[model samples]
Target: MGEYNMMITEFPPGYRFMPTDVELIEHYLTKKVHCQLPFSSLSPLFQHIDANEFYNISPDNLVKNMCVDGGEQYFFIHGDKYFGGERGKSRVVGNGIGYWRCLGEEISIYNSEGDVIGLRVNLKYFSESSSKNNWTMQKYRLTCEYDTSDTEIEEWILGRITKGKRNDYSNYF
Candidate 1:
């Protein structure tokens, strides 16, 4: 584990970084958005990538950049807003290759007090070459309570990518 509780160690044998929705919001995304996490903190589970590159690159190429052996790959990316669009209202499309389409309505993540703290938006990647949805991503964003009027700070979100249908979180550490 590293200084910010961002685990940077390679899995010893069977362990993996699989945080629950609350943990993902409170631990990782919260720190990242607040500028408390360092850019050098690299782990097999978590990698940071620019929003433009992340959305523009093909999922196959993105997998090659992953450190995990298999299953889900996590990333910290700036949540890009659509040109002249309201926040969290539009789907983010890629440049000419493929794009991410939302699965359904955003799911809310609540704290122990029953307060909504974050939201999870599920998205699937469709390639222009093939019609199949090969990649799945869960984008996690903090709610208004965490915002401080800084759009830049609020743009950070945690993205989890899976090869196919989402994996069972119980199987991870």
Candidate 2:
């Protein structure tokens, strides 16, 4: 396996990582949200969702902002549906469960071959809700790029989860 770095640059303000897809899913599930990206990417996406914010916020709020104005390019994975706006529109991808919107400008990430290794999608959301009556349960899209031949993206996500666990552990001990 080739060693690769899975670093993300554009996101909300206070994201954190989880160790497993289950953990990542559980976190969003409890918030009444559904995540559609691969568990590997989801973990790190959450880790850095809000790395620049200073206030305590809910994951849902963070997710909401991802869909608001100018929040599209911040995602690592893109959704499939397109939300129309003055800048452009957003689209939802991933079996109609995820979304991706354009953030107005396209940024490129290159691979070892100097080929564009990563693609960006604006934020989008799903229509299904984890709860039957909760209208507040809205889904947010992600922006991500992956290499079918490499596992660096997954490992990078796992690293974020590990770091989060360590931080959580330190607080209790």
Candidate 3:
């Protein structure tokens, strides 16, 4: 891994591109779901990939793929049925190597008209062998308002993942 990070965009220096839950669902996901833009335009600026595959790679490679320097986290539009259902979406956070467990912090998303648009949930990645938690993820699912004849709403949810915090004690001065 390199000692520093670099972004491949022309957004000037030190321009952090951090997006919020509302911006994610409303601005990005909603547009992607409703607009049905051309294939060339369909790719999100944040890029979409399987979350499980994320941890398998090295940090520098992840940083290169992410192409952002605002934060250590990256976002994606993952389509896994296991992560959506009920008022709170169900999720499959594990692959053959490890898994991500939810911390149970589900928040309701509301628009300006006070309409419930979606739900936001948080999760932490746990290593089976080390038995340690070291990564974090936040998922947002749009309610079934945009369901199609052949597809369910759960198939188009968005997720954001980042390195997690360890409870290592550096406090107690």
Could you tell me which residue pairs clash in candidate 3?
83-90, 83-91
Q: What is the lDDT, from 0 to 100, of the residue 79 in candidate 2?
A: 24
Candidate 3 per-residue lDDT, tens place, 3-118, comes to: 35854446687555565667777886776566443334434455556645554543334445543332444445555444532333334433445555667766888887888787
Per-residue lDDT of 41 in model 2? 48
Query: lDDT by residue for model 2 over 1-173, one digit each (tens)?
Result: 23456565566676533222233223442222222345464443443332223013323444553433222212222222332322344444334443333345434434455654333222223344323211121123222444546533231111111101122433532
**Which candidate number has the best lDDT?**
1
List, residue by residue over 28-92, the lDDT tens digit for candidate 1: 88888888777776454578877887877888888776543347888888755522112334354
lDDT of 1: 0.72
lDDT of each: 0.72, 0.31, 0.56
Q: What is the lDDT of residue 24 in candidate 3?
A: 75
Clashing pairs in 1: none
Which stretch of 10 consecutive residues in model 3 shows the poorest summed lDDT?
164-173
Name the regions of candidate 2 deviating beyond 4 angstroms.
1-87, 90-101, 122-173
- How far residue 150's Cα lies from its native spot in candidate 1, in Å, is 6.4
User: Using alpha carbons, what is the TM-score of model 1?
Assistant: 0.76
Which stretches of candidate 3 lie above 4 Å from their native place?
A: 1-9, 35-44, 50-75, 84-95, 129-132, 150-154, 165-173
